[model samples]
Target: MPSAISRFAKFAAIAALTSATVFASLDDAEARRAGSSGFGSRGTRTFQAPPVTSTAPAPAAPIERSMTPRPQTTAPATAQQPFGAQRPGLFGGFGRSMIGGLIAGGLLGMLLGHGFGGGFGFLGMLLQIALIGGAVMLAMRYFANRRQPSYGAGGQGGSFSRSNSMSPANNSSFQIPAIGSGAGSRASSRGNRPSDEIGLAQADLDQFEELLTDVQTAYGAEDYATLRRLTTPEAMSYLAEELGENATNGVRNRVSDVKLLQGDIAEAWREDGQEYATLAMRYSSIDAMVERDSGRVVSGDDRRPSESIEVWTFVRKSGADWKLAAIQGSEQRAA
Candidate 1:
């Protein structure tokens, strides 16, 4: 039989081992090949789609999991017609009715012995048709010609003269502005704004790169303390949940040798007293999952490295160090 002191020693040893495992076990989010899905928050823009960059030209996959409420975005209706819609003809209902009425009245004049100005013979019928057609053609041409916008001597045209139109000229109620015209003044204003509004210094970019390595390192090691230091509360919570789920499944993930192959700024802005920047990065790493107890290979190869393109969002208060706010798998299917 074991002595009470010996049992106490063995139990203490087991507890220490258990504590060590707890610290090292939850590397799921960092160690596994994070799927081509996005999650977490990106400040006020969490639900908004990130802009496309050269490194990530294809549309990014929508964030699958997020703390921010997805905003309802209604697409603006277009002025263009749908495909294959037939336009109304020039000589439509009103024109046809006008021509028909002229013919009827001319024949009635003949029946009533008016004889189209007292001619009444075969030549009179032929004369009536020719006169009516010539009058109609002249009237239509004159009416159409009168609606033209007057031009200055310098050839610049003024606004069109107002008049009652049987049908709108060209059947258009509004003129579509040209591509380079001032129609998009509001959108162009944004494009014209200086990029310095975000004020990302070279130092800031360096910090972002440093954060990338630190975050992945802390995540792979299951170092919650480091993770908490490097990530926002909301992001840490999501990562913690992912690791817990993996731990519950009795698997441990490991990632190493992270290398940033390409990186570019996706977007940047300031709001709510915090500045945010989303960066698209292509990186490669050795990621694998193994059984927690026996350490048997369960998924992923430890010796082989895999590539992933992702958008990482970092947020910080004015003059504060940047912290990871979100990670989204980018549009890797284009590759």
Candidate 2:
């Protein structure tokens, strides 16, 4: 029985050792892919949104500006008619006179014993009074016209002159300032103020390419100081965590021969006093992992280089140096 127990203890020890080695290998592989270009969290997206601003784009592109001009127009002024220019009709001035004459005629007819009704009733009396009033009005109008001076053709000429005096001028001029000119002035002012605009110069673009290489070199060499300087606080934390995991598993990732194959701007914009740029970069590198003590190859190929495409986002304040803010993979791959 004692011999049997000794054999079981030996078997258990071998099993435990094998499990530890397997776990260590798995941890190293995970650490290798942890902070790779196609791995990790993409930082906060401040510009891309459902809530749009003046400078935001309908579709993603480089170098978007908000200084477009608006159209200009002028509405014509309308002419108003003079109050006294409206002429009166023939009965206009004799309304009260006609009313008085009708009443007087009715009363006279009643006193003559031919009351409101005779051969005709109240309607016949009203009709007779109306005819008498109309004749009297016509005689008065004729006398009044006879008293006034006659000017014939010359009177018609005077009427035209009065009409000309009453109507307003037809050719009035109005000035509407051009909106395009104002927009040009605003654009010039913005050009003079560097802070208002966020444009990437050729030199700025070169720096981005240089950083792509420098960051990879520093990370491979386990240079935390260089990583901190080249990346944002959030990105630094992620890189640090990955490196810590690799160290704990007694392994290290070695990246070399890093080269940018192709690159282009995906989108760039300025917001909240900061400039942000997202770039799609295709690169090739020799990426591999090795054990800490014996330096045995644990994962990946050291001699064979691999190519990958990734989207990287960088951000900086006005007149400040750019730093890596986020990273995202083009294709999802299992670790």
Instruction: Give each model a TM-score.
Output: 0.53, 0.43
* lDDT tens digits, residue span 1-335, model 1: 33664454344434433433332322322223334356678877786667655545444555656778866546565556543333333323466455555555554564454534365554555565566656655554454344321211110011000011121112111111111233222333435211224856667777887887777767667789999999999889877876786688887666677666656666778888988887766656566676779988776656766555667889999878999998776544313
Please identify model 2 stretches exceeding 4 Å from their true place. Answer: 1-197, 332-335
Model 1 misplaced stretches (Cα beyond 4 Å): 1-35, 72-196, 333-335
Model 1 residue pairs with clashes = none
The Cα error of candidate 1 at residue 43, in Å, is: 2.2
Steric overlap count per candidate? 0, 0
Whole-model lDDT, candidate 1? 0.57
> Number of clashes in model 1?
0
Model 2 error, position 170 (Å): 74
Which candidate's lDDT is highest?
A: 1
Error of 2 at 197 (Å): 8.7
